[model samples]
Target: MRPEIIRLLNENQEFRLFVRQNPQWYRKLSRDPSALQSLEKEANYFYGRTFPQRVERMQSNLGLAMMMMEMLKMGQDTVAQTQETFSS
Candidate 1:
């Protein structure tokens, strides 16, 4: 199954309820390419909206990680300089 289809089923209560209520129709769509084209379009719509949010979240996480790395590097340099001053 497509991940988008599974995501739609898992995330959208209305869509999941519709599928639960119309199991036969959903199954028919699962087999019918023409019907599935519309369903895929709906899934694509959801995916399009979700993809950007995911990327933004990833970028935020990456930025935080880089900041932490820089802080760690600076702390290490500070400790190294302190050790050298004490030894001299």
Candidate 2:
């Protein structure tokens, strides 16, 4: 491994973890230091560490939450309607 790459592994915990999780990157990077860029990009996407990935994840979660809220509101409305009918 190159000194720069070694230093990166030592200094950046996320990079180290990514490299550890994806051992194939280690060999690729050792063969071509320039492959570091691609490794980082793949790692970021894999781990949901990038801004766009994070945004997409948040959007999906938000949609799920909104759906749950709508379901809950519908349930409450149904209960209220049922109570009104029973009272009448």
Candidate 3:
């Protein structure tokens, strides 16, 4: 993944969700369970320490930023279109 994408996910809704969803393949107790157990323990600690509400806050901020970014892009596109029409 792109670094910026990873950064957004890390700062926003991704790491927690990735940790939450990482262990789906470990559905059964087995002889080689140490890795899975370690991951679970780490995830548990991470989740325990994280304020889940921050995820919601980050999402809201991201949404607002995206809206503004989109508006700016549209504004630029509109300017380009107006310039083209005037040139023609």
Candidate 4:
């Protein structure tokens, strides 16, 4: 397989599935310039659809991490306050 096609399969799960499902198309893509161009465009489309969902999940994870940090800080502050009050 061409390095480009290998990379495409590695990066895009949908493309991997499509290639597996359409072996004849994969052969065509390898031999025909026009078919390769069309496959590349389809791969780009699939990745474009997936990229936004990946970004949204990352954002959600970041927000959850920030919330956890804030809660941890609050817990630390409460512990310090209780220690100071008891010592006094």
Q: Which candidate is the best by lDDT?
A: 2
Residues 40-62, candidate 3: write the lDDT tens digits.
Answer: 45555566544665676688999
Answer with 1 or 2, whichever has the higher TM-score. Answer: 2
Ranking by lDDT: 2, 4, 1, 3
lDDT of each: 0.70, 0.91, 0.60, 0.77
Q: Candidates 1 and 3: which is better by lDDT?
A: 1
Write down the worst ten-residue block by lDDT for model 3.
Answer: 25-34
Reference-based lDDT, residue 35, model 3: 46
Name the runs in model 1 displaced over 4 angstroms: 1-49
Question: What TM-score fits each model?
Answer: 0.48, 0.76, 0.42, 0.47
Could you give candidate 1's per-residue lDDT for residues 7-77 as a string of tens digits?
76788775566567657647655666356556545555555546777788799999999999999999999
Best-fitting candidate, scored by TM-score = 2
TM-score rank order:
2, 1, 4, 3
**Pairing residues by index, what is the TM-score of model 1?**
0.48
Evaluate model 3: give its lDDT. Answer: 0.60
| Residue 54 displacement in candidate 4 (angstroms) | 0.6
Off by over 4 Å in 3: 1-50
The superposed Cα distance between candidate 4 and the true structure at residue 38, in angstroms, equals 12
Stretches of candidate 2 off by over 4 Å are 50-52
True-vs-predicted CA distance for residue 60, candidate 4, Å: 0.2
